[model samples]
Target: MPLGTIVRLLGKQSQMGYLDEVYNSVEDLSSDYFQTKACKAMLLKPLNAASSHCHRLKINIDDTKPREVYVCKDTSCYAHCAFSSVPDTLCKCGKVMEYAGDRPENDAKTAAAGSDNGVFVIGSQKFITTDDLQIGNVKIKVLQTRINSAVLYAEVGHDFVDLVFGLLSVPLGCVTKALSQRLSKGCIDNLYRSIAGSAEGCMGPDYKRMLLAPELAPFFGSGASQILEAAESAPKKIKVDSRFSCFKIGGFSNLGRCREQAYRYNSSYGCNRHEFTYCQNTTKTAEICELDPKLHGVQNSNCDAYVKQGPQSFMVTDDLHVRPLTLDSSLRVVSEGKVQMKDLVEKEVALTKLQIMELQRAALMTCEALSSVLLPPKKKKKNLKHLMY
Candidate 1:
């Protein structure tokens, strides 16, 4: 008998029940029966199985040969999407197709390392991995210079009360009181050296006696000793006017002569009195010193006439003026001070916005690629098989 004729006879005689029972019994008797039974037990199990296996039953709509039904296992239906063509067999409803191969996984480890290694480019600015530090050694040196300058200023402002009295023509006690309130410790130390040096020329015996005193002994070393020796070697005093007495009494002939010598000492030895003002108001003292003594003829003509103001003080100016610089002109303004390493790092990090954005973009692209690979494919209906039994 023909296979079709036999199948028809069996279908009609048992109403397809006998064929289904026989198929089920054979499936149960197999070693993989539990898997097969569980699959067949669901109302939608056959549809899922048919879809996954690319099985589809199609009735030939065309007038083709008898027993020529087509069972298509492979079809390409998702050929027009942006990503790639998808196989129809991947979907439950095989009419719907999808790109159903194992997707490429993103290399997250590579991306993170790349982000760390990537050059940060912003507008015309580009910094590489080697230059990623917030505060480098160069900036640290600049900060150190600033701190040293401050400390020097403090020492000069804190000592040498007698020098202030001699220069300002005030009483020694009054000068000491003013220095206590006005000068920083740095400023006073500087003043003591100046007074000691000047005293050696006219008051050499008195200056040496003071240096030997235990209380003032610490200031007599290295740089201070050289200044004292120079003063001690100079010629004795010639009496000048009482107004010019501070310079003459200290054994220098005049305030102008003392200042000239002081300027030479500062320029050669790095003893920068003019550059080391304790406060903004005291900067005027430097300006006054720089004027032509022959022309301006010294008003408060003592070498140390100017008061040293401490760190927190500033000179108040009545006028609000803005001075514009000429092209290529340089302004010689001193820096305010230094910042600590912690503060420096915080500022640098705050300024690295462009770098942070580049890293984030790289991370997002990496994640997007990875997500496409791990996610499962979508479902469709064309892969279903209609079991008439």
Candidate 2:
């Protein structure tokens, strides 16, 4: 009996299940890809900068097989899509990138390490609390405090506040795993662990892998405050030559249909399949070289910064509420909480990937997410000379 037999017996409609999931992801692999071309145009660099920085996916098309092409000219790609390995100008498909050979023969093979987007590199610029989110030497101001035992809210930038709010965007599986199942998140941890490597027939390993460490949805992610280990995967695209192909091939048989003014068939004067062409000769398969894949409508899979709204000083409450920061709101936190002015402490800590996990767990378990993750401020030593005077 089929698995849906019980449902069928109950007089409910059901369809046969299959192992394969067939869908044309590259349905719009043409139409000039104006979106991607435009996105590339936007990622500008300084005139003094030696190398170019493009945070976009390249469409790599073989004879028919198309895949993603990852390229980073700089040795240090602090933020990148997918897994960025040693910056060697090596595209994801192992093709030596065009820039790898740009330098001298000996200097081209310089050593490079894997990307560590977890922490800010030494001496690198930090984010300033301004509307532009400018890069400068700045520190994270006091965002929260504790007077005696009660914790009070602190004013923070939109990026800083995102460290706590990003929890909602994360999937349940990632939430549980990132916290190492330390948080009390019901039985989700068990459900994630119970999935076996092999499925009887209904699914494959890819499903399991995706569930284990799912990537963020396309074009959605933390701009610079990437506390979580989530990233967007490569884009989906069609073959480069897929403007059109043979009728038998491009007529929705093995491949998808061709584009407008881009259809071809046998070239025989009276060939039965020769509907688009005017005249021709033999119907040999080698003559199949003339046709290309008719690909159109493909949009740019590139992504922009997650938060592009005009910069504003965003305030976050203990209960994870986000809003614009104002003098009244800041005063309200102090008035309502009754936290002492001198009691509030500000300390700078690296918001690395691991620390992000702690934030996620604390956000779920308690309202004081910032205070929960932040260690108690250390007491400073008294100035002996000044105090004595």
Candidate 3:
């Protein structure tokens, strides 16, 4: 019997005697996921199996292959997509992520290493905390924090905060995990755009202008205006070319990388999760090889290409407002004062040492002069001795 038929039958009657016998007859079928009590409960309200971050399922329209569509769970991804295989990857919220089903036999081992949304546990204790969420050595910035208060906030990139995502006074780790779950469901991009778009036509310059200025147009393209135009004109796709600037490929050197545009380069391995192309042969210069007219280049081939890469990884914007403590301009003043004081002390010590050395040399010269002046009668005694002989 079909699963749909069983569901329909289950809806008519709460309990069925033969259902258990039928389930027993089926091979490799477990009662854990299909308990009678669970089925009745699910009939009232559907269950969301995708809630877990370790495993996700992808369904297809056609039925040509087996029904194993399990993929990597990505709760914080911007597009709400899943990965086929686990690699060095991140969710849209900038959390270092791990997939559970990547290694089924050693699932416990994988959990010990890392978990979805950059969370993990060691022994019985969990590492999730509000003080700071770190991926490797890079500190994941907390946008806002309140001790002994119910309200807490976390920075999920693009200068946006995860407000109202956690309990008022819970440990920071719980808050981070809650925010990570929200981010995985495509909220990061939405919140980012909502906040960014609200700044348009404001009184002063916006965030994009502050980080990427007009002088950087040659390498990046354009700033606020170009992005606004792209958003307003085309909601789905944004074109990349020499006209617009301000797109930065993270972890990739933007020097003589792109064949057509010397400054535009492909992201290094693991830098761009999906290997997206910032430039293509669709541009006029790329079609005819304007940089060097001698060589014939493929219209869409030479710009930036990757081979056998994974699915499109969700991309996040950089946060420019928050800087490290060591680079704070206010702290530089105190450091400079301390440096000046140290230099003065060093110079004073050197001067004192030089004076002591000079005094010792002068004393030696004076002693020699005194000996010569006081011992003038020695030659007369020697002459008397010679006459006596």
Candidate 4:
């Protein structure tokens, strides 16, 4: 867990009666006792809620488009809106919701949501998995990679390695929002929800998108791995309303001039009567009017990459420990897992968008990302079907 997450959890628990809880030592505070206490509040939500912690509604987990959910007029219960099927507008908390009829517009990101830029293929690699979630070094056997049985490690080239290493540049808010707060970290989900709810009407859509789904800093993105799927925001430009038009200083008569006879101010700022130009407002002094809106959007970015391209092959363990592929390193991993040659089997795993997302989520929460995401589930295990998106 991040230090910020820990600090926020501690702060919240302190007010909820941390002093009364019994613990053997200060280290015990990090145990499940406190974690359960924190999650206890959200337990009141519906077991199948397809929304976020802030009561924002979504049709499903991968509902990229944010829907306008009904809110309670009274403060009885701020839980998410739930349908009772018998004309009762009940909240997830079982309280009647006073309908606030105004449904705001969807978030700005909705426009670009699900818009694929192009096919992003990471790399090709051969992997082996074992039933007990441990495996050993074996003869180099290449086969079609499979996703369902990768309970061990992956041997990959620099492309896949660069993609994994590129995960550091992703914003935590984007990941949390992408996962819909299934991050299972400190109340980061709640914090993100609180900020989102508080800034709904106060902030612009662009600002809201920035807060919730911030993009990588200019020139710092990996083109090979957009698993997080955060679209780069277009440059925001101020548009001149039709109520006002640009006049050449004292050239009000120029409005009727032909395109060639127009006297307008042109500058080296790349504004050839395109971007911002001298114009008098309706009731104010001379201001600027925008003709074309693409001036400021030209950002000089290189390859949208961070790591240098190379031929280095690496081994990523189930626990996400990345190391160069060498006999010594492979031997150490196999010895640690206590795996044998007989217990291992190879599979072809494709680093697609969805698979990468699962890997990213597992990497954030546990060391056993491979086992947790790729390992087949037991028969009795209950899956989060609503969150499958």
- The TM-score values for the models, in the order shown, are 0.12, 0.42, 0.12, 0.42
Kindly state the number of residue pairs that clash in model 4: 8
lDDT of 2 at 58: 32
Model 4: runs farther than 4 Å from truth?
A: 1-150, 202-206, 223-225, 232-302, 379-389
In every candidate, how many clashes are there? 27, 16, 17, 8
- Candidate RMSDs in Å, in order, are 49.7, 20.6, 35.1, 22.8
Candidate 1 residue-wise lDDT, 1-389, digit = tens: 11112223344232221222222222333222111121111111111101111111132121211111111123232221111111222122233222222222233543443333221111233323222221101010111122221210111111121111111111112222222332222243344444344334433343233332211111111111121221211111122222222221222122243233322246667775543322222211110011111111112223211122232221110010111222221112112223343332111112122222221121112322111211233345564465443
Best by lDDT: 4
Lowest lDDT block of 10, candidate 3: 160-169
Candidate 2, residues 73-171, lDDT tens digits: the string is: 232333222221112223333333221111111222111211322111212333233332211111244445544244455455545543433333344
Error of 1 at 51 (Å): 99
lDDT of 3 by residue, 1-389 (tens): 11212323355231222222222222122222211221211122211111121222132221211111122234333422222121222333434333222112223543443433232111233322222222111112221112211111112221111010001111112212223333232233343333235434431342233211211111011111121121111111122222111112210123123332323344674342534344543332111010111111212221111111122111111111111123243234335434332232110011132222221122112322112221232344457767887
lDDT agreement of model 1 with the native: 0.21
lDDT of each: 0.21, 0.35, 0.22, 0.39
Per-residue error at 253 for model 4, in Å? Answer: 47
Better of 1 and 2 by lDDT: 2
* lDDT ranking, high to low: 4, 2, 3, 1
